[model samples]
Target: MPQNKQIHLDNRPTGEAELSNFKLVVGETPALADDQVLVRHHYLSLDPYMRGRMNDSKSYAASQPLGQTFQGGTVGEVVESRHPKFAVGDKVVGFGGWQEYGVVDANQPGVLRKVDTTHVPLSHYLGAVGMPGVTAWYGLVKIIAPKAGETLVVTAASGAVGSAFGALAKARGCRVVGIAGGPDKCKYVTDELGFDACIDYRQHPDVKSMSAALKEACPDGIDGYFENVGGYILDAVLLRLNAFARIALCGMIAGYDGQPLPIQNPTLLLINRVKLEGFIVSEHMEVWPEALKELGTLVATGKLRPRESIAEGIEKAPEAFLGLLKGKNFGKQLVKLV
Candidate 1:
């Protein structure tokens, strides 16, 4: 067995997260007990949702435990297995957290999952074809169900969830418009991701400016919205929504660090007759198979080409993750542990 390096939460962040909140330590992957499987993680996913988990506050999920490996997702290969269902060298995805190695009890169902990397890249299991992809599917299909020819808008448009939502919505023959921060991301959303239009929110700092931009981009008015970034962006989107627009509230990255984000004129929801629903995709177990199959097919067929920004090692995870929270990473944020 080798020394396993892991990052643990030492304290909860009071405002914005700082490096001091997490401590990196060297530990060992203990010998596998009966029915235990050991996986050597190749990649660690860094997502905005994990930032919310870092705080000891009431949320959709419990706060990530202190002194434990930071909770997130990982894709790797099983190096040892004592269980009948898993074998050595099988590619797997699991909630491996911020560690080089993860041990799971195979007796627990859904603790780890075998993945096929023949068509989809192994790292993508943490992004486009995995939880992020499934999240986009559930939000768009189950919540904001858009009809063909209707206009739909998504914020954080070049990130994992937003990218998947764009591809999925486009396939349904809807006009997909994306909102991102800069020229590069906005370009990728329209050029690579095939969105009908992309709005650069950086060019429009205030809700008034943002609404003007949305008006030009979505002249038909937004019929559905995939809300990844809530704040002024949500306020701006509200102004352009047509009557009876649907909103799938997936993330509120702007307020993840205990910042207050009061949506101005929330009465817009009433006036628009909008169906706004906040969702945690893990709670919807029934949609996984259907979502994964569609996302995997989109990736395999090259219709949904997702991009990634990967840091080199586990030591860089914290910095990379902080960059993710600030929208510095270009695409799906990840750390290559191996």
Candidate 2:
């Protein structure tokens, strides 16, 4: 039998999670059963949604139990396979938890996507060309369906999904406005990603002022909103939406920190007949391949750039994850595990 180190949920968090909330334990790696492949985890993807999983509360996914290994998506190399579909040395992406080695059932959902690194970097498959890529593509092109002349607003605009939304909206010929925390990130959204404008939300005093800033940048009114942080930003965007406007609610990062949900601009929605739709990328799995293919082409052509906030080693995952919740990461947060 082999051995591995795994990180488990130590206790349910009260508010913000600290390193004490997780426990790192070394144990014997479980033997693979039929149709299972053992993998050596190379990278673990730390996302904001995982924060919801730490508490014993109702959510889109079940809350993880105490002492159980906290689950997450990992990119790994197959070390052994009892299944015929996978062989040793195959590079694949799947849910491997936060461990040095683990067994994965081939039939499980979110199973490995075989990676070909000849065309792109392996880590990117976990990021831009992966789930985040698919989320941006489908959320914008399919969900919002912004037209060339439309104005699009994206919240948390410096992060991976938000950045993708802004950049892809720009590529589709929409006037894109990004809302980021600071000047550097705001500049990155405008100067690097080619957004029409960017609003530094941290500097703005209130949602009304942010709304006014958005209005200044988009005199035509926002036709589409690619929302990442919900709370007040959503409220601000709601007040500025044009007639027949579309909003793709990607992730509510602001509300994730235990803030109360803000009320919507009901009168505007009623008058404008705006369309606001919320989605999880997993629900629309059928559209992922086509979206990834399109996004991959964009990356190959230099039209898109994927940003990553990489923290080395599995032990740093908890810290990295906490940083993500605090909006410390600039892009996709990843843990490089060896």
Which candidate ranks first by lDDT, i.e. highest? 1
Give the TM-scores of the predictions, in the order they appear: 0.99, 0.95
Pick out the ten consecutive residues of candidate 1 with the lowest summed lDDT. Answer: 103-112
Encode model 2's per-residue lDDT on 127-236: one tens digit a residue. Answer: 77878878888889887998889998888788878777776787888898889989988888888778889999988858889888988999999898888777777778
Overall lDDT per candidate, in order of appearance: 0.93, 0.83
Model 2 / residue 53 / CA error / Å: 1.7
Angstrom error at residue 181, model 2: 1.2
Q: Judge candidate 1 at residue 215 and give its lDDT.
A: 95
The Cα error of candidate 2 at residue 106, in Å, is 1.8
Q: Model 1 over residues 94-177: C-alpha lDDT tens digits?
A: 998999999999788777999999999999999999999999999999998888999999999999999999999999999999
